[model samples]
Target: MAYRTWQCENCGFLYEEEFGLPLEGISPGTRWEDIPDDFVCPTCGFAKSQFSMIEI
Candidate 1:
């Protein structure tokens, strides 16, 4: 599956779907939109609303 990447608009933190956050219980290949809304930026405390699809 082709995974996409997202960037935190608040902090420029990148969340790559190919390398899911194990600490957050998100397995690899998880989609950006599939991530729960409660999930916050690891670097900044911004919510999912602050993230945008990014081309890497």
Candidate 2:
């Protein structure tokens, strides 16, 4: 599986994980493409573009 990194729009929280099925209680059957571009940050409800991909 491929790994992906995601940044938080609110507090700039960077998170990384393997690409696979979504975790329980967080997202249901959520794929990379399925995620909405206007998705809001869980902590501060910021827009999706506010998040940046973290390159390792």
Q: What TM-score does each of the candidates earn?
A: 0.88, 0.55
What TM value does model 2 have? 0.55
Candidate 1 matches the true fold with a TM-score of 0.88
Record all residue pairs in model 2 with backbone atoms less than 3 Å apart, i.e. clashing: none
Worst 10 residues of 1 by lDDT: 28-37
Residue pairs clashing, model 1: none
lDDT value, candidate 2, whole model: 0.59
Measured with C-alpha atoms, the lDDT of residue 22 in candidate 1 is: 84
lDDT of 2 by residue, 6-46 (tens): 78756985444453324422353344455667666666778
* lDDT at position 51, candidate 1: 91
By lDDT, the best candidate is 1
